[model samples]
Target: MNMAISSTPTSFSKSLKPSLPKARVFNLLKTPPNSHLRYTLNLKPPPPRLLFRIGNPKSKSQFKSHHSPIRSLFTGIVEEIGKVKQLGSDDDGGFTMTIHAKTVLEDVNLGDSISINGTCLTVTHFDTQLFEFTVGLSPETLRKTSLIELQMGSLVNLERALKPSTRMGGHFVQGHVDGTGEIVSTEPEGDSLWVKVKTTPELLKYIVPKGFIAVDGTSLTVVKVFDEEECFNFMLVAYTQQNVVIPLKKVGQKVNLEVDILGKYVERLLNNGVVNAIK
Candidate 1:
């Protein structure tokens, strides 16, 4: 593919300008129709060309989010919408929360873990008739998550724990919220909705454009991440607009955020190697 002259050939004689001694000369031969011109230089042959590989071309799959395989995890797929029936302080200085849901409670148990807006909690009690379940939120959960913003009659995204037979629709979510982000803005594009969230750099360090980020337990692809501004955004299609409670949230409100767990695992692995090498 590397040719001295371009494919668009110039006048063969005009292009060739070789200063030669009187004894030896490169005679410009007559041109052939529809054929590439070749120069038979009666000089020394050229040396062998050297080659070296630099790097691979940029991938077209940059927009694709990676999936992490986890055995018992929340897929970040909201199974149903639930209402906060109770939000009160417990004797342990923690919060006792209750939600009224049906789908997640169909096969629930006392010790079963359920994700409420991406915060994993163990079911302490359930009532088949009432179609509700109770969970206790520890002080650490309140400090790390947006669960403290819950109030009575508030709508929440609910999802049951993953099972072997369950379909993995979204990326692996531990239902452990990394932090809370304030809704900076929301825009409507036709039927879809674009939501922008601003968080601290502590959490933004793990977020990346085209990667996965769970907002309020709904798995969504990050459209863009503004590192300097400490904000990230994702779009919700028409279907998602109706399925989750995110669409109803207005600007300035906080939403629970769970960054992709894969990033954390990679960071730990690489940092450990550096420490070992130093030793």
Candidate 2:
């Protein structure tokens, strides 16, 4: 599995400023646990610049970042707000779901990739009248994500596959849920909310402070990590809290978690070189 990092200076500095070192790529392939990956990304020049104003007065519902990949990539940026219309066990002992969506349904087709709480699902059927789509969930998907907890009228985050022309904002999210986690607690820090989530040791092995984690399909940065507790903390800005459904979840509620794809790739590369790792 070859990983490539590319940036163009011609674009806005906020989109692709500074630059990443070639060595950082190599380090990711060999770094040990507890060692952080270091790279200089100057989306702009020497004197760093803030991409957006601290208080733009825009609706919190407005997603500030629009630059994401175009080719079936999800930056963990929730592009639309969808609601659960139906959820039940299929005849095959699987799960079938109907979700009503607005934005993502505009140009959707029969087999489009739609990220539902960070777990990618293929559209099986759709109703143009209600702007709804149906998806089938394998037993494995239920085991790995919190989608099983969904009920009718449950609001979920939704994002369409990346378009190649968009600018990458969040990070590469394959919509492959690595595991599920539970919210341990939430504390208010000024206007922001800090959430603590607890998971398993096997899953914690891949999380790192400052690393990216998708909580219920929204991309967030891990602020603090507790190895002994098998938990991590992330801050939710006012805008995020207002826009996503995560804040509405109770302390013990389960949430889907997708760790950074880059980390998983690096781990596989180190253990099996490349060919065998993917297998």
Candidate 3:
């Protein structure tokens, strides 16, 4: 089945300045910056206070009216790191999955965004303890990533859809794994290791020096880039604990890769005629 998604722009009204209490005003005047007491004594009384009316705070209803719900965001913990209970194809040629997650229902809702490994899937059903979600992988998504190789007890990271107020801690990620890359080599560099991975040519343009990239849902920065006849190779330098789990990555091990979303948008603008050109 084809998935159709849409997004709406968000807006905010100007915030009204709150009236300062008398104590606070006196404290400000006492500060060193306002030590010119003689000059202030000559000044006339403050102008008639104009009472600024403060409107009610924006509510979820207001947000819903102005924005699309599918674009909402959430983040959840990996409770039990449950395995793939079952996987099979449905009548419509779509894939069905029964993931038995422990503590999934503790905080997860019906439409939460759960990042299984690096791929985001939506919650379809749940009880008080566990929940089930489904991901309909396309032929291209299946061919490009290691989702098919997921076993019964694979550890996966989970995150809910993002809210407008949420601080973007990681680079913008769509939870869409673009392609699978093989680990080339890893060398210890002080407390960190410089990891090299072989990536596709199309993904190479976004892999810039010091640019951000996500491997298996973990955001990492690119340190260097190299090109060969077989593939474009790049090294990611990360700290010990952060780089260890993924560095043991075998020479030919396939890893889910998600290029920085911001990079992709910038590329689109450069190609579409928004900016004069990207320098």
For TM-score, candidate 1 versus 2, the one ahead is 1
Ranking the candidates on lDDT from highest down gives 1, 2, 3
Q: After superposition, how far is residue 94 of candidate 1 from its true place, in Å?
A: 3.0
Question: For each candidate, what is the lDDT?
Answer: 0.68, 0.67, 0.49
- Report the candidate with higher TM-score, 2 versus 3: 2
The collision pairs in model 1 are none
The TM-score ranking, best first, is 1, 2, 3
Candidate 2's TM-score = 0.70
Where does candidate 3 have its weakest 10-residue lDDT segment? 8-17
lDDT value, residue 96 of candidate 2 = 61
After superposition on all CA atoms, how large is the RMSD of candidate 1?
Answer: 29.2
lDDT of 2 by residue, 212-244 (tens): 998888999999899988899999999888878
* Cand. 1 Cα-lDDT: 0.68
Task: Please list the residue runs of candidate 2 whose C-alpha ends up more than 4 Å from where it truly belongs after superposition.
Answer: 1-71, 91-93, 273-279
Query: Across residues 114-168, which tens digit of lDDT does each residue of candidate 1 receive?
Result: 8888877877778989998888655445445656456667799999989989899
Each model's TM-score? 0.72, 0.70, 0.59
Q: Model 2: how far is 82 from its true place, Å?
A: 1.1
Per-residue C-alpha lDDT of model 3 across residues 104-148, encoded as one tens digit per residue: 446776656655656666565455544554443332333445554
